[model samples]
Target: MSWAVLVISGVLEAVWAAALDRSEGFSRPLPSVVFGIALAGSMGGLAYAMRELPLGTSYAVWVGIGAVLAVAYAMITGAESVSVLKVLFLAMIVGGVVGLKALH
Candidate 1:
């Protein structure tokens, strides 16, 4: 359950990140609201997960998931350019996340 929450929170981190970018410094109402809601959810989930998981492992996993998803989202939406090297690096991050999970 804790791991599930942590993963969900990680995805929410990406959502909030993308929404924040769309918020344009909080100038946009809808995106800003989305950002706020997602940010709260993400943090709440992270805090909850930390209750059962080691801090360093949880943090690294959370950040890894969020970073990969955020950049993937940007690339898919054409907000960021995609490249072979970028994909390769993202795969490496995913590998590290999986490795942590396996170790845990």
Candidate 2:
């Protein structure tokens, strides 16, 4: 359950980040609201997850998932240019996350 919450939080982090990017410096009403909600929700979820998970492990996984998802989202949405080197780096991040998970 804690891990699940962490993953959700991470995904929410990505969502909020993307929302913030579209907020036009907070001038856009709808995107601003969405950004606020998602940002708060992500932090709230992370707090809940930290109750049971070790801080180091939880933080690493949370950040890793958020970063990877955000980059992938940007590439897929055409918000950023996708390149072979970028994809390779993203794959390395995924690999690191999986390796960390496999650690005792």
Candidate 3:
């Protein structure tokens, strides 16, 4: 359950990041609201997960998941360009996250 919540939190992290980008320095009302809500939810989930998981592992996994998703979304939406190198590094990040999951 904790792991599930942590993963959800990681996804929320990506959501908030994308929202933040869309917010344009908080000038846009809708995206700014989305950013605030997602950010809060993500942090809350992370805090809850930390109760049972190792701090370092949880944090790293959270960041790794968030980063990969953010970049992938950007590329998918054409907000960012895709390249082989970028995809390769994203795969590496996914591998590392999976490796961490396998550890425990």
Residue-wise lDDT of candidate 3 within 1-104, one digit each (tens)?
88999999999999999999999999999999999999999999999999999999999999999999999999999999999999999999999999999997
* Model 1 poorest ten-residue lDDT run: 52-61
In candidate 1 the C-alpha lDDT for residue 63 amounts to 96
Q: Which pairs clash inside model 2?
A: none
Per-residue accuracy of model 2 over 1-104 as CA lDDT, tens digit each: 88789989999999899899999999999999999999998999999988988788888888888999999999999988999999999899889877767882
Model 1: residues with Cα > 4 Å off, grouped in runs:
none
- Give lDDT per model, in order: 0.96, 0.89, 0.97
List model 1 lDDT by residue over 11-102, tens digit each. Answer: 99999999999999999999999999999999999999999999998999999999999999999999899999999999999999999999
Which stretch of 10 consecutive residues in model 2 shows the poorest summed lDDT? 95-104
Model 1's TM-score against the true structure: 0.98
* Lowest-sum lDDT 10-residue window in model 3: 1-10
lDDT of 3: 0.97
TM values, all candidates? 0.98, 0.92, 0.98
Models sorted by lDDT, best on top: 3, 1, 2
What shift in Å separates residue 59 of candidate 2 from its native position after superposition? Answer: 1.1
